[model samples]
Target: MTTISRFTGARFLPMVPALRRAADRVPERARLPVAVGLLCEAVLLLWWLAFYPGLMSFDTVTYVWQVTTGHWRSDHSVAYDVLVWLSLQITGGLAALTFLQTVALAASLGYVCHGLRALGVRGRWAAAAPLAVVLVPSTGTFGIFVWKDSAYAIAAVLAFGACAHLAARQRPLLHWWLLAAAMTGLSVFRNNSYPAVAVAGLVLLAAMPRRWRRIAAATLVPTALALALNFGVYPAIGVQKPSTSSYYAFNYADISVAYHRAPQTFRRSDLAVMSQVAPLAHWSAGGSNCSWVDPLMAPPFDRPAAERLNGKLLDTWGHVLAKRPDLMLSAHLCRGRIAWALPRNDSDIFIQPPVVPADRFGYSRPGGLMDHSRFLPALRTDPPSDGLHSAGVWAYTAARTPELTWFLWTGSLWCWATYLIVLRMMRRRPLRSALALAATTAGLQVAVLVATPAGLFRYMAAPVLLGFLALPLLTAAHPADRLPGADPARRGRARAAARPQSAPPRSGAAA
Candidate 1:
């Protein structure tokens, strides 16, 4: 061969061999983490290419305002706002935020993969598990979206992984710390997660005697810290207390119940407070629980007035429910179905070329861009490419289809299913600790049912993601046998030797 040919051959020849050798060097057990990490990087790249800096919703804009102005809002998590502020300071835009989220998600899922391998899943099966999770539309697609829900989901998975590790090994100080950190993130990232962490912590304390002290500390520390930050520290630092409209957690339920069951539930005096923004007829004619409270009655009430009215309305709500329990229950279930049963949520959740209108919430479009420009310059000029934008539209469209929609919509059902299945599985095997962790994670959906107003998929993303990821752990054949430091090869050989053999292969050649 000529010198040029030799050079070309030398360059090209090692590429395949190099890949094979690299693949061989990666232990079978480590393949799953590597694969998950690569998938996460790919996802981050696709999102960056598609949305450039990042996608934003109305909430995202609000968060930016809060972070930039130092005017904290109780309606949103201060912890999350602080996170965004700090991240923006370092990376200068949503790019860094999204990048960190992708890393978090990859690490969380990799931990799940580690747990699966530790639970006796074959290396190949464990490697394939994360791919399955990634294929689930609600999981992989919504995961990359820029929202507090994304962080909560990552935290939830990390907590689950920590629980699985503790369940299997029942030792290791690192796992305890990991659980605490994960729980802290899970609890603080979203307000609704507070109760879920509380419930899980209680479960851990009650069920996990071996690690109850550590678990209790893990659970309580985060819970207390979250409460302090949200209630005490935030206000001390000049963060506005959440307005009464935001405080009355069950406003939607109260309005829906009153509209449907007791149209006369709200006194004329109470209606007078709401009438500043919406007519009594509007509250009475409420078809949707959300419509009755949001953009209408609730917006009219300022902080102090809202606080008084909410107190009165809550009492009235109680009386209405007492008189018509059946109707009230039905209304609650109906509203919850919107959150838990509907496959597609509001149209704007993942909108491409995000519609930040000029007059939205007192911030003009240009002003908004200028405001965010300090951290995100690409927001002004880099609209998503046509191909990636189209791909996003297509993916979302596919998610809305009947089959895939079920995964997205039925997250609550899956959580319940996981809880029930874990309970049953625990009875037959040594999965008490892991099962308890999963059950608590699944129980988070119940909290969503109680606390959330409308069924938004983002609200339940963490629980749904956790339930799906827990399947391998819940169904492992020999969970205890696969604890850390146990020898998989030795176990495999032992199983092979124990199997009955009809005859030896000694006579194969002669016979």
Candidate 2:
């Protein structure tokens, strides 16, 4: 009876040999990269099919307009506009553009796994790392979104991952080139990234060892070029200066701080200048944060009027900050909490289709605002398939729940954690190179805290995504092995001992 049962089971399990054969075809070293690539492709396809074409916010509309027309505005990064224009030229639609973005994201993540493998992580854990990334709600969902923030976040991840790889490997020329390219993309993708990269470069310069000093130049040079392009080259070509009103956006916290702490300090003349854009009555009602006096809500003033008020706006803000530095600091802390503090904030910048005038988009579906026709033909004019859309919505909703939102929103916290972990590890070994990379990421988070207009989730995306991607690198073992001057003889012995010997090494043999 036992022999008969065994024969029956063998006959039924016909796929066992084929499964083993297929698994055997993938080399052990290649498995992680292969799994990561396939997972990335699957996610991209799923995102495309569900949201088909792509998802967009108001910023997406503005960017598309800027690209379609030659008119350049400083409100949006012309550098990013150029990328969008290039994508449009190549794919003639958003699908291909998103597909390219997916590839970049996957490649950046694969670099992380590669760095981990180099740092002595087991192959199985390295391969499984991508799964953790995909399962993390914020990390995977942002890969599908079509915003400059999304592009900037992806570029930032690549730049950091490349830096990590360079830090962990002895042969770093290739990684250096990769880091340079990624940093260049990062610098151009967002206006705010300039300062972040600059800060990171400084951190790298200060933290890296003497031998790795050249890598500092890699971060600084690209950042300088990006600054030249944004400030010098764009105007040389034909881009118009960004609106003066845009500068006022930075003064929201200032205005709020003044109003809340010392409303009497604001001279009547100061109020008059501000009234040119926002209604002083409404502003007074709104008080010391963006909720009352958002620069976006400020009415557009003609050039002469705007220029005159812009001068006053700057002068008044400077006076307020100078006179009441403490209040300014308090306001910044209060507003920045939404971005840096844990437990998440209520601001959601991921609103799809956007909320504009109903007539603007021609659609009458309940709350539809902008006309769907204004978008490129490639973008889906109607909603996606119900099943796919529903599933995406459900997942997104789940991700947004308070418990998960805390993790999703605390990207800055993650950077600080990375910095602390790297700093701790450096005490016992030569990990300054990796420490520099992690510090750069932390610096970017600090930049967001200092410079972001409000605590919007989108503003924190890059730091959040980067912090998660840097995990394997931060938590890796054998920190000394990846250092620049570690003894090769000792490393060889360690590796030999780590592997199982076939027999006791036959006394006199090479082993």
Candidate 3:
């Protein structure tokens, strides 16, 4: 073969012209503006890695250990761990692992930039937004954290974009299938991330044309398989018993007890006390009167002592609700307040005396591991709290010449508001998209608080991921419009709009 033909056969040939076109399309004068953005990203990334690598949060260490040991059976989704394992094998040390982490983070940030560019943002501007996202001092700041959140967020964005592309009829079957696999992988990453995958599946379903029965078929088959793997088949095959902590058990116990006692109202305090004790009773040695579910709710509940107290409290709550009218309203409202104001920490952590005691029984058990875990120590020791310490801003403000905490809070609230506004706008034509996104965020937050052993502000990262993706699109001027430029190559393909609107003719067919 001629040298020219051999060169044409190389992989780079396909992408070479595209690169040239990008250069041609971007005005020569735009280089400085683009360079400024790239330089800013470099500076911010360096600052984060140097000072607060991984932000050293509580869950990070467990993940680090998991990666180092190549032990992943305990983890739900092992993608990040798998990546770390591969990177470590290649690099062979902690320093290499750290560098690998930054590289992975940069790649994920680049993917976010790609999403932005597809939405009409210039490449440089798109790139800078993810940096701004990283600099926002919220969930994105944890980008370097070894936990699955960063990886899950990246997977989610990729899945969302792929599903969106399929919806737009831009990508092929192979791409959608790959995206589906990633979504499934993400579902197992962290307990909270499962809902995002479920929502992504819904997006895929919505994107497909109704005539294609296979779309619904495709969506349901994977989810069904996942269910079988998680609940039905996994256990039967000895994979692992589904870990059901007492947290969810308690919620169910509370609802069930309330249901039985509902006809005879109760004072809110009465209900609260009853709700707290029922789970304890269920787990009590002699307290068979409480349901099995109560035990589940009180996984850490002390046997006889917890059950005996819970039974009495349940009866007391039922009696009080039966008797007091005004107290009922007070009790119902109080329950709502408690639910809303509930701490984002594992109740088990609070169970320990000396608050942040050296020995607290966490999910892994004997529970002292709880206190030893990364975030738990900070939660116990980090004082002045958000309100008292003004979120630790005295030093930050001195350095930055601004109240970073205050600014972060204000900016977050504004971004949150913008997210809601976008949801409202999308609700008209794409209500399912808006609702699915909203539900994924809100439902997971509610579920996480009720189910998980740990609850931290960082737990809210999944929702924030969606909010950032939707933000630029929300802020942008155009709606339902294609990006500004057409591929000059595709200009020839742009034919009569008057053509029949069913599916386009198969490739190579004459009009």
lDDT, candidate 1, 1-511, per-residue tens: 6999999988999798999899899987677677776875576566555555555566776787677776678677777787778777777666677767767777777877777666565655655656555565457655555578778878888888787777666477987898899889877888777778877887776558776778789988998999888878878878898766666746634655566556666566656555543455655555344312343334333445556566666765676677667667776665566335544445312223333344443444565533444543423224358888667656656666655555554666667667775666677576566555573564476667667665566776676677677666545656455434555534576766667887756677955
lDDT of each: 0.65, 0.64, 0.43
Candidate 2 runs further than 4 Å off: 1-31, 211-213, 290-296, 299-306, 343-385, 427-430, 473-475, 479-511
* Rank ordering of all candidates by lDDT, starting from the highest: 1, 2, 3
TM-score of 1: 0.82
Question: What TM-score does candidate 2 reach?
Answer: 0.80
Tell me the deviation in Å of residue 143 in model 3: 1.5
lDDT of 3 by residue, 152-171 (tens): 55555455444433433444
Whole-structure CA lDDT of model 1: 0.65
What's the TM for model 3?
A: 0.53
Q: Model 2, range 73-95, lDDT digits (tens) per residue?
A: 76677776776777778877666
Candidate 1: the clashing residue pairs are 339-455
- Residue-level error in angstroms, candidate 1, position 11: 6.9
lDDT of 3 at 66: 51
